[model samples]
Target: MILKPVPISAEQFTPFGDLIETGSDPIAINYGYTERHHDLASLDLLEQEGRPIVSIFRSTPLPQPVTLNVMERHPLSSQAFIPMGNQPYLVAVAPAGEFDASKIRLFIVKPGQGVNYHRGTWHHFCLALNAVSDFLVIDRSGKGDNCDEVTLVEPITVDLSDCEESTAR
Candidate 1:
């Protein structure tokens, strides 16, 4: 299977989770010295069985034409990634349920954009493009086995060169 990444936006990504983007709507706060895009995403971590953990992930960039061999999810908590700097990345997601390859959608995550995956949302791991990137990760720290993985029967190939071609034209 092959997938093409679509441009990401807040509205288009709502079904999976929140899209953290600060557009032109920030309000001044803290004695008007701060611009706050407050409460942009529902940072959901399962409270009944686990404590929330905050960590930083420094990921090396993946080259283009990547192969996606597996998908994973956390059943007990939602996961979020906030990039440390402006960088483009790739995000691929499928709805939570019986794993279906046809339902997967790919997005080109632009700079200044972040994602919060709803609990149990199946997703590919971080695919940083162009350069190494750092992200602030928030999720659960618990006793339960929350992580789940499914290997695809046939790995999906994702080529971003087509995207670049369209842009260049």
Candidate 2:
């Protein structure tokens, strides 16, 4: 039960891949007043390894777009995303140790950035608009199924919520 929340930046994402691009687009405010453009980019990371092991891919992502209901938790794994095309939307779930209304955050994987999830870390699925979101994922892979879901007692609004309490940490 630990709530150590930190940003998965270039230094942290390096072990997973290389940062070579950055791009962005604008996201409008609700009142139809203020508008802000976001940056996105493409990135490449070479993860060297021994003999034949995990499969290498151009952009293999989760088949199903995780339609998150509020936020959820995974008791046994951490998930990571590396934005390859457009900017990525990062929502997340958390263990009680890391759960705090003032702490949970979202990360924008601007085109050139990517990430590697530590084991048993709670997270949200990928969020991207316009073009396809791509990434090189590194995680435990096996024939056996590996997924567990836990609904939160209270749901959190992803698109519409208080500005301060929600965002990538």
Candidate 3:
């Protein structure tokens, strides 16, 4: 089944997990006096060609930029900043449906918070909204395709109704 992208805010995104907002660690916001605009397309790939029995779709989502203010870092993850790109990208997510509150938690990454994917942990694709996000990924990169997935029991509908309303304000 195809899953539409949903926007998870830090406030709401955390319950599903922990708020990895680092602010006290030096690697976080301690980078020496820095001044420069950086552009990055993390997973933005291009679809090559289609074969008789196969099709291709490159990373079409254009990379969006935002300032990532940091304070600390996750020592476990090797990846630095995993781009969530402009349009919210759908990675692997819990199947859409009711789940055990004990096993699954709902959390949102606020506009300023970006999460770095550990080498192989399961997660939803990047959800870039308006600004640059500093993410501290965690996992084992030694393994190829370090990505696995868990379809939620049902499906989730991202309610952009509020964002739509706020946009008009």
Which regions in candidate 3 have their CA more than 4 angstroms from the true location? 1-103, 116-122, 129-140, 164-169
The worst-scoring run of ten residues by lDDT in candidate 1 lies at 160-169
What tens-digit string does per-residue lDDT give for candidate 2 at 69-132? 4443333333445554554444343433454444445444544455544443455555543345
Scored by TM-score, the top model is 1
TM-scores vs. true structure, each candidate: 0.92, 0.45, 0.36
lDDT (tens digit, per residue) of candidate 3 on 65-133: 211111121122222233333333323223223322123322333433444333222344443343433
Model 1 lDDT per residue over 12-49, tens place: 89888889878687899999999998788787686567
- Displacement of residue 23 (Cα, Å) in model 3 is 2.7
User: Candidate order by lDDT, highest to lowest?
Assistant: 1, 2, 3
Model 2, position 128, has a per-residue lDDT of: 48
Q: What value does the lDDT take at residue 127 in candidate 2? A: 50
Q: Residue 58 of candidate 3: its Cα lDDT?
A: 31
* Greater-TM-score candidate between 1 and 3: 1
Comparing 2 with 3 on TM-score, the higher-scoring candidate is 2
Q: Each candidate's lDDT (Cα)?
A: 0.85, 0.41, 0.32
The order by descending TM-score is 1, 2, 3
